[model samples]
Target: MTEPVLCPADPAPVTLIGPPLAPGPLVFLGDHAGALIPRSLGTLGVGEADRRRHIALDIGIGQLGRLLAEHFGATFVSQTYSRLVVDCNRAPFSPGAMPEVSDGTAIPGNTDLAETVRADRVAAIHEPYHQAIADLLAGRRAAGLPTILVALHSFTPVYAGKARPWQAGVIHGGPGSDYGRRVLAGLQGVQDLTVGDNLPYAFDDTDYTIPRHAFPNALQWLEIEIRQDLLGTPDQVAEVARWLAPVLRDAMEG
Candidate 1:
């Protein structure tokens, strides 16, 4: 028999912010928005310090996504569990989805995970999160409303002791990443901003959200990454959103 993924007591896997029928053509997603683990998982045996790290969640994306959605009058969908439990951005059953180790830090909870446990995580977390996104977009399409999908994320300023220079990055892949490139150009036009075009990382084999919801539908989309340091406080979060919201608006309009 297949084991269940989440306990009956676990919180909902996805959080939908803003109105379902918001004004804008944008739908923002934060795959690693929260760092909360199920009470049963017990932090995946990780320490509090590591639990708060990037391996657990995208440091400030929850706030960032919320702010952008509010400013743009767009619908925002986010995962409220830690990526360490099951990365929503990755394909189910993929190694990166439930990484045993991330950026050289060992995840004790992930080690030697049983097949049943892995499947449970996917059933509980990954499946629901993606389903929410897919359903939201489908509803929009059925209503004949224009849609632009944007995935929000934050990256650690330094990884494995190596410092990264760009303040922000835009990840695009394949021929379908035209909207991503336009977002790159829009942000680049901002003054005093060092924006990387597919720097630090690129959208590739490990990405599931965009491929599953955006590309196949041929939706204009972008996966945006902000340096975690820039999102250290509420003011910082607003500052980034203030500049970024308009950039995205122009990208969609242009």
Candidate 2:
């Protein structure tokens, strides 16, 4: 018998906040929101401190996503498993989907994996998380509702001994990314904020979420990356949501 990646006691792979068919064009995604590891995974051979680090999850995204969802009255779908187990934003079985090393820290559990093990991670966590998003989008499309997919993420202020200068970043690509450009411009207009235009990362073939759900559907999409340090407290998260919500609302309406 094949062992399951998620036991019965494990948390559900996807956490959806707000109505699936909420009255709006915005849909928020927290692809790396949680830091939960399956009981079966045994911490993936990572120490406690490392498990709480950015490698395990995108810090503060869960709270921020929920706040944004409530503010916009849009659906917020988030992954509940650690990205160290299976990065839901990457294609299944891709190197990044189950990284062996992240930011120079080795992932012992991911170093040598049988194909079946990798498949189980995808089947249990990655598939369900994305399927929920897909199903919600399909339903919205069937209902003739316009959709704007916004992926929320957080990055460490420092990576591999180097400090990042940007307060946030907006990643967009392809011919259908006009909304993303508008968001970038809006963020740039914010006073005392340094926003990167795809500096920390870019939208490319390695990305699976937007390309998988947004591209073929031709939905306007934007992937926002905030510096993790800025989200260290509840007040900080709320402040971000406050400023960001208006920018997104204006971008969508403009």
Top-lDDT candidate index: 2
Tell me the tens digit of each residue's lDDT in model 1 across 160-249: 789999999999987467778989999899999999889989877888888888878988888999999999999999999999988898
Q: Cα RMSDs of all predictions? A: 1.5, 0.9
User: What is candidate 2's local distance difference test score?
Assistant: 0.93
Residue 165 of candidate 2: its Cα lDDT?
98
Q: For residues 1-254, what per-residue lDDT tens digits would candidate 2 score against the true structure?
A: 86678899999999999989987999999999999999988988999999999999999999999999999889999999999999998889889999999987899999888898999899899999989999999999999999999999999998878999999999998956889999999999999999999968888898889988998899999999999999999999999998899899999877
Report clash pairs, candidate 2. none
